[model samples]
Target: MPEAIHTLRVALPPEAVWDFVKDMNKWAPMLTGYQKHTIVTETKSLWTLKGDVGILSRTVELEVNITEWAGPDRVRFTLTGLNEAVSGEGQFEIRAIAVAGSAAAAAAASAPVAAKAELSWWQKLVERFARWFLGRQGGGQAALPAAPRAAVTAGSELAFTLMMEAGGPTAPLVNAMLEPALIPATEDLAQRIVTHLEKQHGLG
Candidate 1:
């Protein structure tokens, strides 16, 4: 089985995050390689995704069933492959956290004054190279906003946990191929959700 867990800090209340995540329709398309989805009922849906598995690319259909919906806290769901032998489960969790916005702002305000120095030639060259490499890795995606600069506020921590495994005669081989894709897919979905919500709030 391949499992991935990603957590992000959002400068918003847990209730706000829950309001967005409670509706799957809003974030389902944020999944990497998402094609389409159909809602069958409140607790069930079907999804189509096209993605690369090792050197081969294919489309898979999955049946998603919500097992629990704990508002302002968590959403747990199970996945069953409709057109293939695969099954998985995942969840989204959000919790409140204290954000020291003023303290951080104060630190940032003093950073330039305390470190007004020029970088050496090699340092400048390395910095430029690092930026270029990071830009390429980002794929030009919209960057998330910086943390809020308001007074101490109530923030939320969002986590997405996923576990997937393939079945059938070729289970081992398929799992090997699937393992490499899980983390990237999980990260893409989770970060996109945070980006969307953060942009909507835009306190930063």
Candidate 2:
């Protein structure tokens, strides 16, 4: 499948970054053409996003399923276009930033481990378990993966990716026609996320 991947360095601990991003409600609006999103259930969501297909601008609802919930590290999900019949998958990965010897050793003292993130923390934990069990039941071994959560002594790096495919005979044409919009959206993912997170700290 065709995929778009973008990565950026975030000036916070991996745990802090994961706590913020694990909740879709907090991060969905960060999409380039995002309009709105609703969490229908713990693992399911309905998202309305906008983009232009050539000269015709389109808005569509997407059915999203969280396939993997690796806390403070990675998350993977798949989406289906409810009205248009397109399907795709995406992932968010966080890796610890590397630094010099003393700088790396001192980095752990800078950020709070949990930081009073009580509201959505439990939801993510529940996601980790639910996705695991569900993935196991319905032949989901490939779909649901347990991402390792290791301690990060330095800042973190965030990466986002998305893959889209038209679910019908016209997939090629659809992908070709939608290439312009898809490219920008995919490229914008990382910058938007970084800017959003940085703004929370009053940074540029």
Candidate 3:
């Protein structure tokens, strides 16, 4: 199985993130290759995505079922491929930022420095794909706010974790192709959610 987990500090409270994430419709389009989604019931939906694997792109249909919905904390879901042999599970977790005087808080503040380490080849490829997909060639026009209007002291943290696996004869090749894109996909969704919240709250 291939899994990707991305966590980032958001300048909003846990409840705020929950308010948005509770409704999949709000963030569904934020996905990297989102085409559309249909809600079948409170806990079931169908998603259509046009994903790029290496140099080839194809449309994928997935059945998403909510496994758990814990307010202001987490939402867990399982994915079943309708038109392909794939399955996975994912979750979104929101929590208060590390306590101010705790070692965790200090480490949280230093996370950016640690993240500045070198990137792997696949990571570099993912970056290029993202830039191209977003239609920005070398820092094009700015769209979002340059900076948040105010600093957030008691903010929250958001984490998204996803795991996927392909089955059958071609599973090996399909999984290999999917490996590079998973991390970026998770990251893009988490960042977009945070950005949208910041903008809505007038922080951006």
Order the candidates by TM-score, highest first — what do you get? 1, 3, 2
Q: Where does the lowest 10-residue lDDT sum fall in candidate 1?
A: 108-117
User: lDDT tens string, model 2, 116-179?
Assistant: 1122558758756775787678444222121234333355667777777776788887876665
**Model 1 C-alpha lDDT per residue in residues 1-204, reported as the tens digit of each score:** 777776676667899999999998899889998999999999999999986678888899999999999999999999999887889999998987555455343223211111001345577677567656765775421122324546656767778888888999998999888877877787778778877886677543
- What TM-score would you give candidate 2 relative to the actual structure? 0.70
Q: Candidate 1: give the clashing pairs.
A: none
Local error of candidate 2 at 170, Å? 1.2
Model 3: lDDT equals 0.73
lDDT of 3 by residue, 1-204 (tens): 777777666556688889999999899999999999999999999999987666788798999999998989999999999997889999998877522333233233322211111356687677556646653652421111223233325566678888889989998898888877787788888878877886787655
lDDT score, residue 190, model 2? Answer: 62
For residue 186, give model 1's deviation from the true position in Å: 0.7
Steric overlap count per candidate: 0, 0, 0
